[model samples]
Target: MRDRIKTDELLSTSDLRVSTAATAWRHVEAEYVDEIDGILATLAPSGPYAYTVSPRMEEGKEIPTQRIVTTFDEIAETYQNLHRFAAVVAIRPVTQLHASWYTFVSGLGRGREKATGQESERPVIVLFPTMGSEGITGELFWGRTQRDSMPGDPADGSLASRFAVAKVHDTLLDAYRSGDVDALTDLAHAEIQAGLRDYEADTGTLAEMHTREELRRHLERFFGRYRVLGIDVVTSHYDDWFFFHELRWTVESRTGDDAGQTYRYHTAEYAELSAEGKIVAHIGHGTDRISAACPGPA
Candidate 1:
């Protein structure tokens, strides 16, 4: 059987680079740069560029791993070669604008169908921008087109509100990535609490606690055990509240029999956010498997 490695043993500078590249590849494919450029001509005059990291795959594994180094470099070269005039943007995940567009559309449809009687007949449409599109005109143009395509209804205002919530979600993720623990604590609502509770439970811990001190202590301990090698926001959704696409760090104990091994794990978390963009509750689910890597000491 293959070895089950711990995260701490394997996250090196090379690992970080590979992970970043792989994520960039995913963004390039999903956005379809060709189509994005066409859309940008209308909404943004500046050119846009994007790339994704190529996920790593084992020699005999059925499914490919998320170590996409090759893909990232390839996409970067492709962008530079094809769009000479447009600034070849550095590879990154889909922008907050894209996330807001997705959340708004998904929630709008669900909300319209849920209203009862007259309210049911009168659906709402919302328009919200999570980020300014100075770099990616194509994304901005596509976003506007998608927003305008929504059916006209009274709930338009409500859709706008949903966009506001998405903005909050994006902001919170940014703060968390920047290591702003205090900012994260202040922004977290029930959804974030719920998400952390789910994380604690999955890792085998206690119940939900509201105090910032408790959370800080818990996070400190967690980080000590497993360093945060990387974080990627893959997708997001908002119903009455907001949800996030979070990729976090996981590590294994290095003492005892299982020593000197490393692995990478992926997780998907659903969260409920407050009006101010704090996470109140969250549920996480995903497969926990060891990733392939070079042999090394723990």
Candidate 2:
């Protein structure tokens, strides 16, 4: 991804297949170069949100993880300071487990070393949510920065260690990829519903499914339109409340003007589980189409 992006252009899609929260985040990053005021407008004025950094090891000593509670003003100020020496080179919106929030992975470029001119990048995971009346009055921010050298979570008694949440996720994807409605039904909460509000689109326009049946029908239509070739999980983390993952997959159009063509997409997703371990909600924050090819063999 480029260091700078034109978000306004991407938000013009006539439908709500994409995410508003993710798009809003991209807008914030894109405006950092020219509109500090715009950045402020998108965030909540005050906050007690948690911001954590992944732990790293150096010289055989661990740089223990750290966290803080901060406000939007502090965040904005930090962004201003960073503008002097860094740029947001890439953004990958991850799926979120909460309806009001979103999460994403970002790459910060700190420019070349003064002497060696060697470039370096930092990876950051941000969790942000909008709150208040109309779900638009303000926004809250929280994040965890994962350094390039940070090690994976150590074995512990966390929920991830006690439950096979990642396996549940894998099964969910397998169900979808194989068009197994029975498996999909078994995995979802009865009242399961999902959506993304497209504030940029015409008012009253929404992309949502209100019940398990609705979700089923929607997937049936989708499966009819595209043949899912395969899905590969790139990375994932599971906790008590959410299962976060990154995936890359390819598909071929089944019946359409583009039939027979193949397309590949990379996405980040979040899933919420019910007490019975079924998925209560699943949100897709964003998807980036990485490539497309001409008609290919089945």
Candidate 3:
């Protein structure tokens, strides 16, 4: 039988300190010590690895010690030290791994601090899966962790994927807000069709708004009546065939007569997209609730 594993499980936690060490090595050659030093500074405050040492002295001689005076100075000194030890660097990879692991551990630490209402440290290390080990790697790690711990689905979806979706949503919202009808059309999917049908029915304009032109005209008229202040996403979820969002909109009437009337509305939008991320359908629930006021006719 094939080994059964749930994809939602987090695999191995990354060591942020090790990850930082690896990052430092990757960019060590350049004058980007300031940047590398920033990475190191994130490791646990007051930890042993926080200091920088000079290159090893001659054999049987006391190793010369150099306290890293300034943050930039420390980075410069550490870079030189790394160069000197480059030949005998057996556990460099281990350093990187530890850095990566520390990242995760550090984040957990922060969460704990927040729960207890502790002051947050600057340059706090936080763990995030590297590009290579994100979705699948995290799933595997979580799966293994679950095997030893309690049972439950690990967080579904990779952080990168979720961030990508967020970007997509943001881009679409920008298009909509800017009245970039073409861009909006490009991003729309089948969900838009379903949404339009509902809108037409609810607004009692079913027969009049049939074609894309008619729909665009109607939207222009409707949206033209309001100045959108913001569109905030409330939630997003997806299954095999569809993705949807719960969105909140803040808008003020554009009509001179209703100039001061601002509204906050909730919408439930469903989207269907093409393989390239173009939206094919955009469907939703929109209810306008008065939220603010500007000077206008009652």
Clash number by candidate, in order: 44, 2, 42
Score every model by TM-score.
0.37, 0.47, 0.38
**Candidate 2 Cα outliers beyond 4 Å, as residue runs:** 1-40, 43-162, 196-206, 288-291, 294-298
Candidate 3 structure quality by residue, lDDT tens digits, 210-266: 234544665666566766777777665542223455566676766766565777655
Against the reference, the lDDT scores of all candidates come to 0.36, 0.48, 0.38
Q: What is the Cα-based TM-score of model 3?
A: 0.38
Off by over 4 Å in 3: 1-166, 189-192, 196-211, 238-241, 293-298
Point out where model 1 deviates above 4 Å: 1-158, 190-192, 195-207, 246-262, 289-298
On lDDT, the leading prediction is 2
- Write model 1 residue lDDT over 102-130, tens digit each, in one string: 11121211111112212221122221111
Q: Which ten residues in a row are the worst by lDDT in model 2?
A: 197-206
Task: List, residue by residue over 1-298, the lDDT tens digit for candidate 2.
Answer: 4523545444443122234455545445754344666655555444432222222233643222222223455556655654444444444443433232333433332333334545665433343433221122222222222122112234534544325666677788888678787788778766554432221121221234545786677666667777877777766776544466666667777775767777776555555565456665554433434447643432
